[model samples]
Target: MSSPTHSANTGRIILHIGTGSFHRAHQAWYLHRLRESGNEHALDWSIAAGNIRSDMNPTHEALAAQNGMYTLETVTPDGVRAYEHIRSIQHVLPWSPDHAPLIECGASRTCRIISFTVTESGYYLDSRDRLDVSHPDIAADLDGARTTIYGVLAAILDARRRADGGPVTLQCCDNLRHNGEKFRAGFAEFLERRNLAELKRWVDEHTTTPSAMVDRITPRPTPDIRPHVLAATGFDDRCPVMGESFAQWVIEDDFIAGRPAWESAGAELVDSVLPYEEAKIRILNATHSCIAWAGTLAGFEYIHEGTGDAEIARFAGDYITQDVIPSLLPSPVDLPRYRDVVLERFGNPDIRDTNERVAADGFTKLSGFIVPTLRDCFARGASPSATALLPALFLAFLARWADGTLRIPYRDSLLDHQEIRAMLASEDPVAVFCADRRVWGELASDSRLVEAVRTASHSVNLWLAARHGVHNRK
Candidate 1:
C-alpha cells in the first residue's frame, strides 16, 4: 500500500471524490499518462480517491488492497485490446460511515484540486437547476449532517475556509450539461440553504469550479474481468477497469489553484467547453439513451448487441443525423464527424455496455441531454420527430416497468414509490411521464412537446410490438 504521503516528490495531490470505473479509466489514466509525459511537475499530480456512498465500498476496498494500481483493458472496435497498469492513484481512502477523513483532506494544504465523477443523478438538482434542498441527504447535510456530495463538499469547504486550506478546484467530470456552471450554481444554493454566508463568500472568491466534458465507455466491472486482468498482468487486481480504447477530456481551463498539464497527455484544455459539451451531450449521450431504451425494449442485453442490429443502429443514426445534427448545425464542431465517431464507439463489441445501465436514469438523461437539443430545435421551428422518439422510448420503458417486464433496476434519485404508483395508475402515462418537471423541465408544459411524445410513444409501442412478433389490436 502507498499509504498517505504528501510532498512535491510524491506529486501535488488531487483528492478525487467518487472512485468509480469511469474515474479510474479516464481521469486517473490521463494523470498516469501525464506522469509518464516526462514532465517534472507531472509527477506531483496524483489522486487520493474516495466515494460519497458506501455501496462503493467493494471497489474502494479493492483499490485500497491493490494500492490503487490496476490494469486498464482498452478495447477497440476492430477487436484490438491492450492492458496497461494505472498507478496514478497514490492513495485510496476507504469508505467511512462519517466522512471525517474526506473533510480533513479537503481542509489540508497539500491538495489544491478536488475532482469528481459522481453520475448525473448525484447532483441532486431540481428541474430549475437548483439544489433540491428537500432531498433527504441534502436536507440532512443542511441539518449539520453529511451524506450526499453537497453535504461532503459543504463540510470540506467549511474546513478549508476555517483552516485557510487554500483554494481548490472542483472539476466535475460527469456527463452533465455545463457541469461546472451547474455545479457552482447548485453548490451556491446549497450553501445558502445551510446559511453559511461567510463561508459562501469565501467559496465565491477562493474556489473555482470548472466545467469539463469527459468521454469513455467504461462499463461496470464484471467478475470475469478480475480473472482476465490477473492473466494479462500476472497480478490480482480486483478493481481492474475495462473500457474502449477511445478517451477524451476537455476542460474549461479555469482552475484557481493550478492544475496538471493534462493537455500534454491527450486532454484539451480549452477556454470554453460549451461547444464540446453540446456536441457530446446531443450526439453521444442522447443517442446513447436512444439506443439503450430501444435496445432494452427490443430485448438486447448489451449496447453492442443492439448497435450490431441494423434496425437499432439505424434508429440511433437517424435520430442523430436527422434531429441532433440539424440542431447542432453551423457549429464549431464537425457534427457529422462527431456523430460517426460516437456511433463507432457505441459499436465496440468488446465493451459490453449493458442497455439497462444506459436506460436507468432516463428522467435525468432526458432533461440534461435529450431535452436541450429538443428545446433548440423547437425554438428554431424545427420538427421534433427524431428527438421525440427518445421520450417515447422512455415511456415504453416505463410501461414495461408498470407491467413488471423490466428486470434491471431503474433508479431515479427523486422518484418515490408513490410516484411509481401514480405512474401505473395514470390513464395517460405518456403525458404524465412527460409532465414530470424532472424529465421535461418547462418543456412539460409545452403543448407541442406533450403531443409529440404521445404520438411518438404510440409509434414506439407499435415498433416494439412488431419486434416481439405481436400484433396490437389498436
Candidate 2:
C-alpha cells in the first residue's frame, strides 16, 4: 500500500472494500464533499478504500500512484459539465490474493465503518432470501475461501473480534432492495454455516447494517474523460470518474458506531429508507433496465438513445405511472415528479451510460426490480402489462444473446450459460423462462404472470419487427 499524500490524522477511518467507478463517483464523492465543507464532524472521518478482488488492479495502481486522489467529472442533463479534485480516500490498499491488508484495516478499531459495494448478484442470495450455498463461490467461501463478500467479511469480523477491536458498522452500498438487512442475514448465515458460533454471536451483538438507497448514473470511465479532466482541471488524473450531476443517498439512521455528518454533504439520514429504496429500485432501476434492454434490441448503444425514442419512453413512462406508482401509493416521495426526474436523468446524453452496463445481471433484476411490481399489481387485481414489458424486453435481449446475435457481449453474474442454451433449444423458450423459480420466485406458478409475460413478449417482438420494417411474427 502507498502512503497518502495528505498527512495522517487522528480521524477515524471508513474501510470501504470497492474502488470501482460507481463507488468513486458516489460514496467517495459524498465524503469528499463532506470533507470539503470543513465541518468538524466531517473532518474527523476519512475513507481507506480498496477492492476485495484484483479486477480493478489498474484503477488501484493509478490511485496509489496519485496518492489516492482523482478527478470526478459530473455532467447534467443539459450538457453542463463540472470537474472536481476528489481527495476523500486517504489510503489505497494494494491488491493481494490473500486479502491480508484489507482484513487488517477492517479489523482495526480505527475503522469504525466497514462499507462495501459489491454488485447485487455478489450477495449470492436466492429468491427466498437464503444464501445460495450451492454457488461455487459461496461453497468455496464456506470452506475458508475469501473471494465473496461473505467470505471476506467473515474473515474481517473474526479478526476484529480476536483483536478486541471495538464495534463497527457494516454498511452495504449496493442496489439490492433492503440491502443492509439482506446482507446482514447472509453474513449471519455464513458464520452459522461455518459453525463459528462465537463469531456469529459477536457480530450479531456488535454490527449494524443500515439499509440505504444510492442513485447515480455513473458509466464505466471511458478514455475520453481523462483528456477532458486534464484540459479542464489542469490535472492529468489517470483514474478519473464520471457521472450525471444528479445523485442521491438516503440511508437508514441505524449506525451503531458513530458516523460522519453526511447530511451536511447532501445525504439523507432517514429514519426509514423503505420508501426511498422501493422508489429507487422499482421506478428508477427497473425502468433503467427496461430502456437498456429495449434500446439494445433497437440497435441503440446508449441509455439516452432508448430514453429519447417516443415508443421506448412510453413503455418506461407507463411502467412508472401505471404499475410502480400505484403499488407505491401513499409514499412520501412525489411519485409523478420523481418519475419525470428519473426519466430526464436517463435521457442525459453526456453521461453515456450504456445499455450493456445497465442490462447486465438480468436474472437478479428480474426478481429484485421487476417482480415486486408484478406481484403487487396481481394482488390488487390490476394488470401489470407495463411492468411485464421489462421482463419481456429482457426475454428478447436474452434470445439475441443465446443466438450469438447480440451486438454487445451480455454479462450476467447469475446467468446459467448451459441452462440458458438448453432453454433456448427447447420447444417453448418463453414458457421455460417464465417458469424459472429463480427469477419469479413463487409467482412463476401464477397463470396471470405467465399470460402477462407471454403477451408482453409478443408485443416486444412486434415492436422489434416494426423498428426493423419486417413482418410481425405469428
Candidate 3:
C-alpha cells in the first residue's frame, strides 16, 4: 500500500501541537481512520507537530525520518491488528525558541481546529485552577512577549488573532473535568492579570474551548517494546506508542472558527460533555489510580498482574461500582457497563502498562482524579470502604518514599522525592504530607477524610510489619 498523505484537496488543516504518544495513538490514529473510511473531505486535515520540551529532539528526528508516519498496533483479545500508514501528521516544527511557525498555523485561515493532549500539568495552573503566573517558566514566557501560553499555545492564539481569524475550535484532550473550560479560564486569568484586556476580549469573542472526555490506556514505551516497534515498522523511532484496543473521545461542539466533522472522524460531538467527563474521571481514571498504587505496593508490576490478584481487583471494582458511582447526583451513567469496559481494558496484556509509571505523581493524580470522588462520597454521607483506601494507599506510597522503599523512576521532575522524604520524616508524616496547601488545598483539613487516611496508613504499616518482619525494606 502507498503511504497516506493529507487530502489537501479539501483545504482544511488540523494542527496537533503536542508530539506525545497519546496524541499519536488516539487523536492522530482517529484522524487516520477517518481518512481511510472515505471521509475524503476530512482527509484534508493535516497535523503539524510542535514541542517545547528539550527532550523531544530525538522524537522529532525519528518522526521526520519516517516521513511523519508510524505504525499503530491495537492489541485485543482476539488478536493484534496493525496499521502501517498511520499518517495524520504532515510536518513537525523543529524545537526552537522562536515559535513563529506554530503561531502562524493557529492563525491560518485554513486552520479551523486545534487539538492537544498536553498532560494534566501542562496547563500551568495553580491548585485553585487559576493560571500560575508565579511559575518561573510561565513568568519568562510572559516577560519575553512570547506568543504562546506555556510557550507553544500562546503563540498559536497570538498568530490567529493577527490573521483576523474567526473563532477557532480549541479541543483539550486532557483528563481533567471541564478541561477545555479550565484552559480558557486559565488563559483569561493570565490576560486579565497582565492587563491585556483587549486580547482577552478578543479571545472571549473568538475562541471556544470545548470540554472533552478522552480515555485510552496508552502506556509509555518500554525497552522491550521499542525493538518490536522498530522491527515492525523498519524504523528506529524512539518514541513508539503502545495502547489497548479501547479508545473514546467525547467532546462538546463549542468551536469558534470551525471543526473537523470529528464526528465524521469517530469522535462523539455532544451538546454537553459534563456527564461523560464526570463518569470517565470518577470511574475509569479514579479506579486506575487505585489499581496503580495498590497494585504497585502489592508487588504487581503490570496492570494485568494487578488485576489478576483477586483482592486488589475486587478492591478496585468495589470502590468504583459501589462507592464512587452511587455518590454522584441523578446518576445517568451505567456503572456496571463502565466497570466491565474498565476491567477488559486493564487486562489488555499487550499494553504492558506499568503500575510504577501510573503510580508516579500520586500527588497530582490523587487530588485531581481520585479525591473528588471521595469527597462526593463523603458529601453524600456514604460509608468508607475500598474507596476510602485510595488516599490511604497514596499516603502510604508517599511514606514509603521516605524510607527509600519506593523510588521515582522518572528523571528530574517537579515531584521532589527529597521534599516528600522530609515531609514523611516530620513529626506527623500524614499531616505534613497533607499540609502542602498547594497540593491538598482545602482538603488538607477535612477531619473525617484525614482520620480515615490515617487509619488506612496504620493498616499499611501493620501489613508491612507482618509481611517482612517489622523492618521490611522491600
Candidate 4:
C-alpha cells in the first residue's frame, strides 16, 4: 500500500506524539470530530503522529496506508457503531534516529499546540518527581548535546526562540494529578541539570502547561478483533483503536501561544481545573485500581465482567464512597452520583477494559493513584479496611507475576522485574510490603497503616493459596 500524502488544512497544526491506542481513539478522534463540524478552517488543526519506540513501525505503516484516517469504534451502552473518515491526522512518522522533522513541526509558526498521551513512564521521572537523567535514552540524548525530557520539545523551543516566536502550549493528557505542574517541574529540573537557566526562564515566562482531566477506556486490539476492525473500517489497520463511547477533556484556560477555541471544539475550558482533576483522580482512577487488582484476583477478565458481579461491584463502590471520597482535601463531592457513573462506565460491555491491562505497572500506578487515598483515609482517622486491600492486591498481583503465573509487558522492565523479585524473595511479605519506602513513600513507616497493610497482605496471600489450592499441590 502507498503512504498517504499530507492534505492542506488551514487550521493550526496539532502534533500528537505517541503510539498508544488511547491517543488514536481519544485525542485524535476528538480533533477529527472538531474538524468535521465545519470548524477545520477555523481551528486550522492537523495531527502529525510520531512514536519514539522502534516497535511502532507496523502501526505507522498501517496508519500511513490508510491516508492518516481510519475508523473509531465507539462501544456505548446504546450500541456499537463505527465512525469512518475521522480525518484529523495528516501523517505518521515512524521512530527515527534523526528527530529534526518532529522538532521542525513543533516549532513551525503554524503549529500552535503539542499534546501527549505517552503513559506515566513516558515522563521518565524519578521518585523525587524530577527528570531521570540516568535513563538510557535520556543519557544518549544528553551525550548527543540534546536536552533531555524528549529533546524534541527543547529543539522546538530553540527553533521558536530563533524565530522570535512565542512559546507554544504544552498540553499533557496523562493520568498524573497536577500533570501540568509535574511536567513544568520535570522540564525545569532537566534544564537546571544542563545549565540552561536562560532557556528555562524563557519557558517559564512564555509557555503554559494546563492541567487537564481526560477519561476514556481504550483497550489494546487483540488478533481476534483485528479482522472485525478491518471489516468495520474498510482498512487493513494493524493498530486500529477501540474505546468506550464516553469521553471528556477538561482543561484549565492557561494557553500562552493561543489555542484552538477548543471550547468551540467541545472541550470544557474552565477557570479552575483543580476540582475536576481531584474528582476524576480520586474517584475514577482510584476506583479503577481497586477494581483492577481485586477483580483480577477474583478471576475476572474484563471490567464489565467483574463489575457485573454484585459483591465485587458493591465493594468497589462502597470503598470509593465511604473511604476514598471523604478523605480528599477539598470539600465533599457527590459520592453517590460519582459511584453510579463509575459503575455505569465500568459496566459498559463494549469497553472490554481488561483487568490485566489495567493491573500493569502496579508499582508506579499504586503510588500515584492508590496511595494518596490510603494516606487520606489514615489522616481522617478512618479505617482503610477496604482501601488498604488495594495495595495488598497489587502486591499479590506482582507476586503472581514474579512466580511466572502471569506475564505483563512493562515500560520500566528492569525496575519492574527487580521490584517484583525483591518482593517475592522477602522472608515476610508483610515486612516487605510495609518497608518499601519507594512504593509506599512515607506511609511505609506509619505503624497503624503498616500493620493494616501487613495484615491485609497476609490475608490476601492465604486467600490466594487456599483458593488456588497451592498448599495442597505443594
Give the number of the best model, judged by TM-score: 2
Stretches of candidate 1 off by over 4 Å are 1-11, 53-55, 94-100, 400-474
- The true-versus-predicted C-alpha distance at residue 162 of model 4, in Å, is 0.9
Off by over 4 Å in 2: 1-9, 398-433, 470-474
Residue-level lDDT tens digits of model 3 in 90-178? 76666666766566666777777877777877788776788878777678767755534444666676667877866777778887778
Task: Give the count of colliding residue pairs in each prediction.
Answer: 2, 0, 9, 4
Q: How many backbone clashes does candidate 4 have?
A: 4
Each model's C-alpha lDDT?
0.83, 0.90, 0.72, 0.72
Better of 1 and 3 by TM-score: 1
Tell me, by lDDT, which candidate is best: 2
Tens-digit lDDT string for candidate 1 (1-474): 246444423457888998888998999999999988898888778888888889988778888887788889888999887899998988787677788778877788888898888887788887778888777877888898878778888888888888988888988989887899999999898888888999899999999998888998888877888788888778887778888899989899898999999989999998998888889888888888888888888778888887888888887888888888777777778898888888899888888888877887677788778888788889999888878988888877777877788766676655775786688588977667767776777788688898888888778878887877743443
How does each model score on TM-score? 0.87, 0.90, 0.85, 0.84
* Better candidate number, 1 or 2, judged by lDDT: 2
Residue-by-residue lDDT tens digits, candidate 2, 1-474: 568644433578999998998899999999999999989777778888888789899889999999889999999999999999999899888888999988898888888999999997799998778999999999999999999989998988999999998899999999788999999999889998999999999998999999999988788788899999999989899999999999999999998999999999999999999998899889898998999999999889999999999999999999999999999999989999999999999999888788988899899888988999999999999999998889889989989998888998887766678887897788988789888888888898678988998899999989887877743342
For candidate 3, the TM-score is 0.85
- Give the C-alpha miss distance for residue 175 in model 1, angstroms: 2.6
